[model samples]
Target: MNRFAGRVVAITGTGDGQGRVAARRFAAEGALVVGADLDAAAAALTEKLVRDDGREMLSVAGVDLTDEADVVRFVGAAADRHGRIDLLYNNAAAARLGDVTHTSEADFDFTFRGVARIPWLLTKHAVPHLRAGTDPAIVNTASVSGIVGAGMVGNAPLLAAYGAAKAAVIRLSQICAVELAASGIRVNCISPGLIDTPAVAGILGTGVDDRLRGWHEEQTLVGRIGTPDDVVSAAMFLLSSDASYITGHNLVVDGGWVASGGAGRPHRDVVEALEASLAAGLRY
Candidate 1:
């Protein structure tokens, strides 16, 4: 659509999944994409794929997003290469599922720092360039876990830190949006639910994909798992002129899972139990 023609986009975790998808999408729409990832080879591959499609892409491999110095350098390089930053997608994150008791200090720090603090670092550096760019906007990748309590599965507390950190990201978006609105910049967050991404599959391990996928699909009102494209589309909307009036909003791209309430047998049981209570006039 060339909606981003002449614009510059800087995205993190571009090695794969939604990060790579977003990089390609923006590039195809005529933006000069700057992609950074910890996995050098994967980042290079993403650059190759986009360039092969005749799109402009600059790939920086092995980025330590949580490091302030590294984030400064990354943002500086993007601005230097393109003379401005139009969109900054804070798409990089690392997660370890464990209850607060079992989750080590290191793991908890890593998850929260990566999910929440990294975006703060990037935005702190990118805002100046964004302030001067055309239609500048920022999209942060939060999760439905942030909105809810990650109570769908038995291991809900296992992701306590991750969910809390993501909730922080949503709050960060709101704060950044209010702070940047005067500067002609918009900040928004997306809370996705059970998207079919490489990271999720990796976390699920072998031989469990089909079963988990099926469960999630049934739980989601859309009756299917979300794709990278679904997220990228929502991201593009916030970054585009169409969402000019939108800011500090958390868009739930969960296929109506959150709106519908719960999932599978547990959700049904909750409803049935509630109905039983109401029908019995047990209100005191």
Candidate 2:
């Protein structure tokens, strides 16, 4: 469990959800953690969680990852604090839901920058220090949305831009992996399915229809939605030496959603329609 002992990890979007959980996990595993988020209070809360567990962590609030200068400062601070950067987790994201027809330029831009550009900026700045560190790795957060847009349609029809942005991230990770491998730095990504994080709850909102949740759970082969911990565990593995030979890989941690086709009732409708046609004895 001390695989990350003495390592320095810099992660983004640590205010809540996946980022917060990642910070705590890395810190718990003996890494010196640095986390950044626009939500000052939430970032501070993540720091407190680490401190409460008797771990060392630095939380930077009001960090706009899209800003090159801000990202430079964040990465610079982490390297300066620990004298090297051992791992970088690009866990921050901005999601605006809308299909192409309804998606505005603003929404597409936000989603693209948050999911793709920000990680590139961070990696650009962190590469030098990571190149010098031990067992260095970068883990970016992608989504099943990037691989397939089928499952979330019923609940979030506006995820076209989000899915596209995530797909870009997967490509980015592969590029970085190949480019950095010679320097002993590994780059990879994790694609999570409908994880039940605080962010999800807030997005779904209180009193919102439960059908969305039901649909996701039913489609997943595990028979349930994923959790932040589920994702954090996969991320930790990718960052660990056990995966030393792995790079340029997109690990799907979706509880078999992608693997099993994630078929739900809507898909079954085709079968029902076919059966009804057969009963009419007019099938072509």
Clash numbers, per candidate: 1, 1
Candidate 2: residue 210 Cα off by (Å): 2.1
Could you tell me every candidate's TM-score relative to the true structure? Answer: 0.91, 0.90
Instruction: Report the alpha-carbon TM-score of model 2 versus the true structure.
Output: 0.90
Model 1: per-residue Cα lDDT over 1-284, one tens digit each: 88888889999999999999999999999988998988999999999999888887988888898898889888888988989999999999987778878999889898988889889999999999998799899999999889987534443566788989999999999999999989989999999887778888744343756665566676777887789999999999999889999999999998888886745334677789999999999983
Looking at candidate 2, the ten consecutive residues that score lowest on lDDT are 198-207
Error of 1 at 179 (Å): 0.9
Return the clash pairs for model 1, or none.
98-158
The sequence of per-residue lDDT tens digits that candidate 2 reaches over residues 1-284 is: 79888888899999999898899889988988889998898998888888898887987789899999999889888877888888999999987777789999998998888888999999999999998789899999999889887647254576789899999999999999999988999999999988888777744443687776776777877878888999999999999999999999999999888887877334577879988999999757
Off by over 4 Å in 2: 153-156, 202-206, 264-284
Error of 1 at 174 (Å): 0.4
